[model samples]
Target: MAGIWAISCKPCELACVRQEVHARDAEAQLVRLASSDNVLSLIEADAGVLAGMLCSTSDLADDEAVSLIERVAKLVTCPLIVMCDRLDPGLIARLFYAGATEVVAGGSSSSCEPVSSKEACAKGALRQATSAGAVAHSKEPAKSASGMDAYAEPARQVHDRTAFHYASSMTTALDEPDGLDEPDELGRSDELEEPDEIDGLDEVASRKAMGGRSTSSEPGAPVICAIAGRGGVGTSSVVGLMAATAARMGLRTAVIDLDLMHGNLPALMGIDDPVDLARLLKDSDSVSETAIEATAMMVSPGLTLWGSLERPELAESMGTAVEQLIFALRDPADVIFIDTSVAWGDAVAAAVAMCDRCLVVGAPGPTQPESAARIAQLAARLGVARTKMVSVLNRCTASSLNEEFALRFEMALSLHSRVRIPDGGSEVSGLLSFGRLEDLARGESRLTSAIQTCTSSLLKELGCAVPEGFGKPSEQDSGGLRIRLPWDKAGEPR
Candidate 1:
């Protein structure tokens, strides 16, 4: 049970009951709550011992009174007690709702005849509280002052400044209630109950369930994933393959081709047209599901591709649009893949920074690993974590994975999967240009199988559905056009 605590208890009658309880419950401590003068000083001196607080009603009206209280509120994870003189009904309601565990009367008169103005003030406060619908839970009231020599100096220091005035011939009697524990003991009881209530993974799973494939808006979700590599290294192709894999497994995936200068997803994916992504983000309210649908062509169940817009001049205007589109797709997307431009630019960097993960794709070559490593280093400097990144080794065949070939290329990216494009000769480029990448998820092609295996592996890692078709990608396939590898080739540079 939580320890019962009160503040400014110098005149309090309940101290006796508190002391007895403290004596009876060897493990428990009855306590006095903290006041402004000492609470902040103590918190600053030893932050760890601090738990929570109860604000006195007088301090709420005085802005400086809660200065320490507000600061503590932001730091500590414990609950607060709200001790009031006469709480505003509205204020009381809001306080309780905002995590105040209990509210109790703080200053009140305990005697037959109230002598001091402060006593009259406290009793009036009690009446005001009663009028505001608060119950009189504390049976006894606090005692008032005797002569000028009465109070202990430390007790008087609770208020910031004091200007004392003596009443004509008033003398108030005070007897410390048997042995009430002070405020510190009360805070200790609360600290013991808090950790278990807060330290669970319920929030993460709920957010993932609501926000597509990524976990909630918390610290875990990798919002940004970049695909960066040398020119003509199949970067866009890998993005389409990854997006296709996500969609095939029932994810509402979006493939955003960010290569404004020479974006070919629209042409490469065979759309042969332009979709105004920049315009959609500029006029966000007008951009809805229908607008996004028009901007992105559906390739499979829960998957869509936003073809590149025509004027390369409009690339600068596309950044905000991409941001808006990502925000809008939060609940709908299981995976969002961005196909980066050939050269790293502000837009490409911005896209990489925005994603939860990055997939740097490269072909079997000398410079690929070095370029990928530079990209990884920059990402690391910017605070991207190792787990949030993976390298994609595209178009690798058994020949590409061989010891001699691997010796020449030192891999830098996540090489868990490799993409393959058959030598369909001249028409291969034309056919690939118009085809939606989604076909790879269902077709009887080597490329399709390679992509499916990669998707299954990713979904399993992220705790998503594991379809029966899921299989592991291997280091080699003797004659196939494509084979996945878990490690980068030897020569590309580590």
Candidate 2:
């Protein structure tokens, strides 16, 4: 509750004042706002309470008080009640100027003995408090005491959440090689948008962002990232890891698992199962940020997730998901991961166009030459620059046969930055079995090292500052490889 400072007041006076404050729910909402050495603390805060501390009058520190008032005003989300011991026109005026939403005199009409000049002071403070409350209650929606309307009530503000924090201690899972089914020659998976179908990438981007009909004013480029590959290749795992890492790095990271084929990122990351995306699509107009965001549970203070839908048909409604997905990423997250499917449909193409980075994961197979080629060619057609693209070699192995896979795949490898991932082995099993990779990232796992090196390299290329201890970790952590005793399967190959 908001404090009413006592200055040599009689016992009766304290009881009378206490009764008045306890009677009003608004007064109960505000607690004391304390500032000392430039640090302010709000105590016993009620969402709608108004609070103010006493300022001396004889010396008339109006300018100083005004500055304090303005700063404090920004903190209170509800209307303010400014209490003064004695009403002075100058003080009242200064309070308003300094951003006190309301000002009043503090006192009661009763038989309490007066303390130091308290008789006058008490009356004035009561008057100000009463006036402040009345004025605030009359205003439409009652602007918070600080008179801040926008972002004034932070706890109440809501939006769809994405999980992509640049966290320090999370694993970045690599998906298996992407698979491609041969279609007609015109089935060019490489070209997200057939050049002839749309005039340019901007045109397709415009349509995808607008969803054919967003009347709201255009917003900044909606934050998005594309995590895609074929079924069972762990597209969501990579998406989850990106989100986990981003969150740890202090960026509010979010993951929008657009994998309508099989929604597992939420479960894999140990988050809640998703609500129906098709149902959300049907009610797209009603999909307010608050409702949509509620679907995601915060993995940490910095990370959150908006999971994917379960049904195969849910992907059919992806056209609408793209539109809303943009709004979800606007939160203060460092990164946004969009886990997608292997089938390169128009929906996937639209997502690829909007992403800041496109990571394609693949394994070493003779067909990888052809599959990677199709992905790179399609990405190029979509106007994705070579610099913005990344190709990760998942579960890489060297077979005696087809010894020159890298050379043959040079055509696809030339299109973007490349990271050769090492076998995560048990780390992968841990993520799948335990639903967390914190231990794996902390261990001296080759895959973890590769992820740390590669992700930082990509970040540096993207012009973002390289994070600390990324490629450099404590020896006990990931910096140095562990030397196990001979009995501990020490020589086993990953």
Using lDDT as the measure, the top candidate is: 2
TM-score of each: 0.47, 0.50
Q: Over the stretch 74-141, how does candidate 2's per-residue lDDT look in tens digits?
A: 54433333444555645664564344434434444432111111222233221122111112121222
**CA lDDT, every prediction?**
0.44, 0.45
Number of backbone collisions per candidate? 35, 52
For model 1, residues 230-289, the per-residue Cα lDDT tens digits are 777767766676666665555556677778778777655556456666545545333444
Minimum summed lDDT over a 10-residue window in model 2 is located at 179-188
